[model samples]
Target: MQEVPVQRQHVGGSVCLLRLLGGDGHRTVRGFLGGSLLMNCKYWHGDEMKPTFWCKLGTDSDCAADIVITSKNQSMVWRERFSIRDNHAGKLFMVTTEGLAEGDMGTYLCKVQRSTTQREESYGVKVMVSTNTSAAMR
Candidate 1:
């Protein structure tokens, strides 16, 4: 059975409060080892442009340590396996990974960096990778 996406918000104990918005904010996304995974995140903060980052959930709660790819305007990380696209009119960002592998299996967070604030407002997505997709279907 397919998993259902959830929506929720999280507040840090400290001054910074991060809210998860859009997509499967509470469900884990499943994919085959060799397949690709796609994620979409949205944020709106006036006309000023902000940078969007995708990171893996590491041993520590710090998201910065697991940095993967970042996108801003028409520029972003230039990597063969990673790509990002933006829906300019809708303020939606799409992150796609090619040749998914065991190492890629993990929880990921997407956030837009607002220059006005020091804290990062993000959306969390869990990813589960399987080596045998055919067997799992049975």
Candidate 2:
């Protein structure tokens, strides 16, 4: 019998090959004023349930600021404009934004806590918001 090796890439001192598993990588998502957008993150097939958090990347720090939501203890709080939803059967989380505004334009991250001290994160999702109507463009 022959053995096949799985390919891997090191990302922030962690191995992340989820991009090859039908998951999104670093990319930009565009939305228009008064529109909506969805960002997605997937879990490995057998990953133990852990806290999932969505946050906006900070301008001046390695840490993420503007935490959008989290799935710790199966509890969550959402602002009127942002929310996070978990799909257990699909092993993923969807971060949604409604009534988009210019302030919503930025980078976001989806992270999963593997353990008390370990976490895995998806590539950044940059959000771009534009005026949806010609009158608004002026």
lDDT at residue 17 of model 1 (Cα atoms): 16
lDDT of each: 0.58, 0.57
lDDT of 1 by residue, 1-138 (tens): 122342222222111112234543444566566666666666664522666777777778657453554545464464677766555566756677767778877778876776675666677776667776643122
Clashes of each: 0, 0
Name the lDDT of candidate 2. 0.57
Once superposed on the true structure, which residue ranges of model 2 sit more than 4 Å away at CA? 1-25, 75-77, 132-138
lDDT tens readout by residue for model 2, 3-110:
112223332222211121234445555656776666656666654256666778786634456466465556344767777766667777767677778997787776
> What's each prediction's TM-score?
0.69, 0.67
Model 1's lDDT to the true fold? 0.58
**Best candidate per TM-score, number?**
1
Query: How well does candidate 2 score on lDDT at residue 19?
Result: 21
The number of clashing residue pairs in model 1 is 0
